[model samples]
Target: MTDASISHLQVLDWGLLIYDDALKLQEALVSERIAELSPDRLILVEHPPVVTIGRSGSLDDLRESEEAINRKGASVFHVDRGGMATFHGPGQLVAYPIVKLQTKDLRLYLQMLLETVAAVLRSYGLASEFRGRNPGVWAGAAKIASVGVACRRWVTYHGIALNVNADLRWFESINPCGDPDGKVTSMERELGQSVDMAEVKDRFTRAFCRIFGYATPPEVRQRPTERPSWLVLSPSCTESIDRMESVLSWLRLSTVCQSARCPNLGECFARGTATFMILGTICTRTCRFCAVDKGKPDAVDGGEPERIAQAVQLLRLKHAVITSVTRDDLPDGGAEHFVRTVEKVRECCPDVSVEVLVPDFRGSLKALQRICDIRPDVFNHNVETVKRLYPIVRPKARYQRSLGILEYAGKHGLIVKSGIMLGLGETEQEILEAITDLRRTGCSFLTLGQYLAPSKEHFPVSRYVSPAEFEEWAQIARSEGFKKVAAGPLVRSSYRAGEMVCSMRQPLKSYQSKG
Candidate 1:
């Protein structure tokens, strides 16, 4: 049951996603599959109640008015698939396979999809068959699964939806598959019992792999064992490194450069710059992609902000960058601590411009406003990755919440900035979308860097993006209307805080070191 050409398949289980967001992910992956940049991938997810009208569908297919449907807390969309009207909601297993078709015969692909669903149903001791005219799997006279797909350049997307334990009442709103007399049912109804969705997903994955001639897919692609030549860092001056370390130790200060194991640590330290991580070293949230310690963080130190200011003074830093571990344990998310730190830095080094790469402050507008009152040179927050990867990459954070923070700061006349890491299995289209989103929020500065896995225990790096590719991204970001773009293998949120601000020739230029 294997084709020599089909060596591997990747399965991405997105727990729960909005209908539109999942479509964007499919569109992004379709392009990658067409370009042969990525392997075949299956996106598994469940959507909140949504009725999607395909190319052949019309408003007539919907039994309820669009307004009536809205009142029921369901969404409606016109999609580009081959079917008519289809309803997707919780308790339904939706699978979108982004695969490079070996042949252009779409009928064969569609039939395979039906076969996969039928086989999975059979595993539950339910017999299903393909009914007349319509493209779907049926149990007796009732539909158990709906099949529809769209293809681009011989790459396929918009796959099948199987009714495992879905509530059949939602189907009453639409003439399922545009059929006037279609009957829809779920495995729970057919078997006269409830079915475990997790078990159904497992069976479907196995059935899909076996029928499609693919070997068992790995949960995640294995990371490359060796580092690329470009990632090889140049040697730094030991005297400069020792001097900065001595200063940081004397002040009892912490820097993300050391805690996050930033690749630019040696280079930035040699240049007398560091992104000070305040509050405490331990983070309350356990983001899979970060290396910072995660635990119940200690009480905030009242004297820590003064030490950070003293470190800025001793180092003669022109642009002092401040960041902190996510302190969700605090009521204001340590917003007051940020205010105190900024005030102390201003008192100690009036000439030095301040930049705070802060957290989302747990989406508290009042908390963010506290920092905006002080008005640092830059208000930076990392969206970190695409919305599609939120559940797996940084499960504790919300994408819209992060964006809201940036948008709120921008509205208050702050020079907003944000960063994102690459090679976490994200497609180029996704990155471009992120850049556009940032610009819309009036984020003037952007940092695009390669994500390095801190350890095997952390999220694995999907691939090592080449330097040329990174430069190309930088140009694309600038073209998106960003005022300043810092993109490279080693670029970070505060990689070159002073230089980026000075190059802009803004008011912060006065703070640049003359030497």
Candidate 2:
């Protein structure tokens, strides 16, 4: 027996085989042969009508009993892999690559497999992704490809199954991969057309070669030699510095926080307060008065919640405001992530208070329910400007929808807050109407501030309201029964958010007691 170290072998086009039946035996046979070969090799195989179970599989997922499975001319066997149970049959291409891991990193291998399958599917005009926390090639929310592999002695055994032109009815007989709630679909299901299996196999081979050949082995890099600059300041100064640091750290994580350009960041940081940006940085829709970059956004980061939690802990923040760029990209409008981040922050620092400035979620009641379920201390949604200017100032968002979101939060007993920017070419009557709309929504907190044009390329500012006008608006907002009203040149959403939320609770409680 040649004991050649697997890493020393430079792999080329290895081997391929197709089996029409006995899939479990085929997998076992291939695995045994690859072990005997004991070097780097790629083996492509196709299985006949069969069902395989992974490590997380349950027998209940199968419709037929073990004896019935054999009587039906198919077989069932539990295998070592990650996902649950799934069906393998003729017309589906299953690749069982027996490649030894030189780097011993399973995550990198899984990611590579996902990208390779997605690339192959994309060639056929199919969009796919390995959505975070989901282990497969997904076309939208349906699984097009399933992956389950096991590594023994750092050598992989089981591999992936791409549903090219497979009969999907078999999936109905069982909870495919034991995911009772998940829908099992194929390329045919998505395109409403049959796919050519032979052509798909060819594409898969080419894609595999391209991805594996060029794939760089995972590596661990040394930490940065230089330490980050640490700023020391007085108790007041420390708060401001910490707040800025939290926001900066959040931005570095590639999530969205509207670069608020609030003049009060310095002061808030001095008080050790920060406004956390959740979801992602890009907005699905553009608003005229805001400085947040608007465009087609990338996918929401699943790790954002944990990072926000870590930021709260790192800053030792007593109060944090979590806000996000509008994410019409998601069905939930990123409300789930917002709730998750809030929950995580509360878990990390139970004493700290959390405020969520959420989007309208396209008036999704389910989305609102998901957020209300979290029971954040405050729920804020900005109207941006008056209803008359809504079309031009906040075109994609409806004025009524914003009101509804705040109303829903209030109805659920959350402290509801909304803000409007002045100097958007609105009349005093329009401003009053907007305030009335907000009050009708049961919003107890109001913030009115001058709208400063972020850039010359952006929407031009119509006018900057004078300090006297802001004061008058504040008075009007108070008269409208807003428990806490802040109107000024520099007030932005989440600016001194803790102070606002803290101040409103007393008056609201008192009002409720009187009633």
Candidate 3:
């Protein structure tokens, strides 16, 4: 039931205090609220690295001993909350609702806490849900927030802890919330940047007040009247997508743009451009974030190159982007297939610029050299994300190895291009370092796009990066010497590829003429 009878809540933001101190404050507030000495108050605090175990929790839940945790600059506490072990540290926003429980039912109170945080996360476009096993907010396989509460004669304290940007390594030192297999992720990790804790606190206070019937939500934005400018497809694009699907299905050829569930699929196909996944639809590598089907793929289609080239000619396209699922099982990692496709496209649509976005070929010099020898108009590869995130994001793909492929292509006089998705939990410094690494490999063009979480099953989108942040990164990339830059929330590797080739037309023509 809505607490529409409640009028207001006093919110206290206590920044970066020790866990014990906050616990003491919660105790005091709980007493005051029960005595009617204070209003229904909410306390927001960022705790120093500490792990708190609930009433029934055991010391065995702590992966590290008290002495070890103390030495590492964190502390452990036995608390009166209702969950097992949970870690709180810098970058995480912890909320303690020192409110008189409007309902005598404990279940409803806990669900309210979960809803309050879930509502706040949803406002930022992050999907937070509670699976039956975990009585908290989860996004995909990662737990975004935990709810634990206590009641002293129906006055509640110790409300919720939602990770805004916490360091996740600390969660590893304990069987957090009694699940050793459960993974902990933060808002920063999910959204791809460090959000202002103060701002998040304000948003949370507003959201909590609204959920508990204390206040109405203020206007932040209106329902969009138009499509997101970047995602706007031509009026005819839908018909084109239908036509494109029919052709692909008939030929049994695959496109990553389709299989990956890229948001730009309709727009790209409608525009008669596609990033063809030539080898097969099934990807060998199971990236946490990719939506591509993962399993054993079918045998390579020998006639794929001819069929793709014919499709290009039939569409009368000016550019064709060919990418592939990583085929680690192959001897040459599908390098020869790339050669066949490029040659076929050039022979059929000679003027159509062929951009091959290839895998690292298992870091083989021979494979890189083989594709470089064919001399496609533009050679593109994607680093996908910054190095630190590779372990979690692209487990099988090495950051350095991918760069080597792009570097080799550039050295051989091909106009090299590489790109990454922003907000993969990469810091500004890490992103700049990644950009510098790409530039060092002689990559001249870059495509920096927001990483969309293809579905709830995939890695949850950490944050909905604003258009302005994308622009800022684009400027930094150009300043760092990227010749052509495409940075935006809706940009994907093959999205607006025709424009990329068009921008480099003068340089490409001059280079080809010299050759």
Best by TM-score: 1
Best by lDDT: 1
Please list the C-alpha lDDT of all candidates, in the order they appear: 0.85, 0.70, 0.79
**Compared with the true structure, what per-residue lDDT tens digits does model 3 show for residues 1-515?**
33555555766666666777677657755765676655677777788899888986888898889899889999889988888889888888888877787678888878878888888888888987897666789977899998788989888888788888788888888987999798988888888998788788778878787667776442221112223565444354677787887887887677887787777777777675788888988889988778888899888889999999988887777789989988998999999999888888877987787888988888989888878777766789999998876766787999888888888888888889988987554667888899999999999889988877675455544345678989998999899898889988878888878878766742333332111
Report the lDDT of model 2 for residue 102.
62
- Model 3 RMSD in angstroms: 17.4
lDDT of 1 by residue, 1-515 (tens): 22467658888877667788678667767866766656788888899999999999989999999999999999999999988999999999999999888867888888888999999988878888986589999999989899889999888999999998898999999999999799999999998898999888889989888898888754543334467998998776667668778998998888898898887777777675778999989999989889999998888999998999998888877788899999988999988899889888988898787888898888998899888878788888889998777766787899989999999999988788899999888877898888889889888899998998897667766678888999998898899898888888888888887777765533532332211
lDDT of 2 by residue, 1-515 (tens): 11234332222221222232223323433444345532344445555667878888878877768677767666677767778888877657776666666667899888887787898888878888776665888888788888988877766767888887778777766677667776777777777888886666557656665666533232111111121222122234544555556656654653222275565666675565677777766777877667777899888888888887887787677778888888887888888788778877867887787888888889999989888777777888888887766655676888888888888888988889988887655667889999999999999899997776676445444455767888999999999899899887777777677888765432222111110
Task: Flag clash pairs in model 2.
Answer: 85-177, 239-269, 239-272, 240-269, 240-270, 256-280, 256-281
TM-score of 3: 0.58
For each of the candidates, the C-alpha root-mean-square deviation to the true structure, in angstroms, is: 15.6, 23.9, 17.4
How far off is residue 58 in model 2, in Å? 75
lDDT of 3 at 288: 72
Report clash pairs, candidate 3. Answer: 190-462, 191-462, 191-463, 192-423
lDDT of 2: 0.70
Candidates sorted by lDDT, descending order? 1, 3, 2
